[model samples]
Target: MKINIQNYESYCLLYIDNELSAAERREFELFMQENSALVNEFNALQQTVLTPETLLFEDKAILYRYDEMEASLPSSFKQSLYREEAKVVDGYFTRTRIIGIASIAAILLLLLGYQFYFSNSINVKNDKENRQTNNKSLKLKSSKDSNNLVRVDANNNLENNTLTKHKSEIAKANGSKLFTSNNLPSLKETDIISQEIKTQDIIIENDVVTNTISSEVTNNLVSDKNAISINNNNSPILNNTNIPSETTENYNTINTDEHDRSIYIANFEIDGDKLRGVTRRINALFKRNKNDKQK
Candidate 1:
């Protein structure tokens, strides 16, 4: 069994007081004899406990003076101490508040900077997209203009062919030798068409002859060549003296007398009384239809 060194002092004190039994005293003496160092330490401890140094009492009042001196301390001294402590605490709190505010400001600044950077990047991206779109639009417009030019050239060729056919038909109808190889010099189709169009414009500007001559010529030219016809419903119709009898019969057969009558009536001048009569007849017809529906 291992003996605890902490209990050695207690064993020695018990042995000196003769409180241990013979078996315990014999075991303690055997333990001390085996540990010679513990025996010397125990003897010194026993001497110190049994004969301690004498304590002098020259200043016995010093022990009881501490409480009274503390009680007699001035209130101002305590207030000053408390004030100093409070100042230290207040400084610590102020420094903490300053740090917190600085951190918050820095965070806010970072957020604002990020937002500005994001907005700028977005605007730049939008600008790039806009530029790309504008470039595409320009390319499309250029392509469209080229296509239009090709279409215009094709249309001009078709118009020249139609004009040549018109010129031949007009020459035959008028029984004139206008396009004869000997009489007129050979001209380009464009030049001939342009000259004809100019002549027609001049004739149109002359109001006195336009209603009679221009309408007949334009109608004959359009009908014979199957060209685009003038849609002027108000144009006056003249007697087709130069037109072939077969052509005249075809025109008359295709259009009914009722159609001619309607055209003539549309062109005819009407008085206010006739217009009022027409309105009254229309109102009576509407009223009759409404009554029939109800029945």
Candidate 2:
């Protein structure tokens, strides 16, 4: 599942050179997919390989010269050469050592430079912070004095507003009393209209109650008709096979009240007798109230 350091570097080099076999390429692709850092490192390595200009020319030249020398010599001489000499001849190994040493020296210098630079930066930042704090303290003191004056001004304005509001409220209350006592219209005419409105509202409430009852009856009749149609369409054998007599009795007993109704009864069952009675009553009422019909 995981490639070790040795294999990881080798695989990266292979991937960069496009030398991986199909299976190896697939493995590396999957590895890159799972590891974002690896993918980034692979990309950087590829960029370096593609653009050798970014690398140190001295290191490259040292290695290149070593390569020429090794290539010029026989393979027998290569095996017999001393480690240091062999490395000098094999330009890659020698250049790696040189580069490594150079890199270490560069890193040391960078660290020292960073320490000095960061320390100076920290000192500068501390000085800036101290100056900013001093400026803020002065600003805050000035703002506090201004705020105190503003608060006093605001208090005086608030007191003036409160007094004005109090006087206005008293004036409005006196005006309301004067209007109510002297300028108010007579209630007798309004009383007649209000009584008429109350009577009309009572009649409207009765109409609403009646319409609600009638709507309920109509809904029940529609449900009964639908159930009857469904019953007639289904095979008698299905009813006999699937439903038992006791279950049918229980189904019929189930309430159709909105709050406590079973889904089957609410959906399918209806009070056919009550619906018919209401329909007949409505017809009779309609006939009796013919004089009240809208023209």
Candidate 3:
């Protein structure tokens, strides 16, 4: 049979108190023999219950003497003793309170210092970031100004080149013109043939001149198509094609128009492809439907 731990503890207490019957004692000894671990626990309990009293006053006369001496002590002395004890207790509590307050103050100071340090670090980081952002903005602005200056220079160069080309073409056309002299010969067949050939050559030259003039007119038309008037404080009004405009407003407008046209063309092509895809899908669906109907 299994014995409960609580019943064993009760039995051990009863045995220590000498309240167990002989039969119970014999049964307990047999149980202890089966569980040898209980023998040490039983000895420990017995020792605890049978502790020897070393603080007993064996002499009655000494005890009476102590009692008389305590009675003979003055009442003021007893009151002073109690007062000293209260003072000691109060001092101990005061020191403890002081230490607790100091600890709390130190902890608060540490927390404040940490918060100050963290805030300072964040502020420093923000300042640095602001400075960096300002520097980057300045650099970007400078770069943009430089790029504008370079663009202006490039425009001036292009205008100068176009002007030189126009001047050279006009010069070449003037040089190609035939200069006539007032001289005549007696009428003859050779002279007539020569005159015919000269006439044919002059006609050809006139045709060439007309073609060059047409080409020059076409160029002027293209340039005038997107002409822009510039209002510069330092430049005078320029109405002649021999001198091109100093401003890039016309060039910029032409580039913008070209870019917009390119974008429109791309979009148109994309829409056309989408329409073709839709048509193909519709055709495939119709073919499938026809096949299904035939089936």
Give the best candidate by lDDT.
1
Model 1, C-alpha of 149: deviation from truth (Å): 11
TM-score of each: 0.21, 0.17, 0.21
Q: What's the true lDDT of residue 241 in model 3?
A: 19
**Model 2, range 84-154, lDDT digits (tens) per residue?**
54343465557546755665565565456545644655665555434433332232222222212111122
TM-score for candidate 2, please give it.
Answer: 0.17
- Candidate lDDT scores, in order, read 0.45, 0.43, 0.43
Instruction: Provide the lowest-lDDT 10-residue window in model 3.
Output: 176-185
- Mind giving the per-residue lDDT tens digits that candidate 3 earns over 1-295? 2334547767777778888888887777777788787778888888887566688678876546565556666888877777433443455557546755665565565456545645655665555434433332232222222212111122333343443344334323434211111111123444334433444343344334434554343233223323211323212222221332222121111132232232122123223344345446655655675687699
Q: Comparing 1 and 2 by TM-score, which wins?
A: 1
How accurate locally is residue 239 in candidate 1, as Cα lDDT from 0 to 100? 24
Clashing pairs in 2: none
- Taking the tens digit of each residue's C-alpha lDDT, what string does model 1 give over 1-295? 3345878888888888788888888998898988898877777766755655798898877667575566765889777777433343355557546755665565565456545645655665555434433332232222222212111112333343444344444443433323321133333445434544444332323222223344354334233333322222321211211222212221122122232222112234334354445546655655675687699
Better of 1 and 3 by lDDT: 1
> What are the runs in model 1 whose C-alpha is more than 4 Å off?
1-93, 146-295
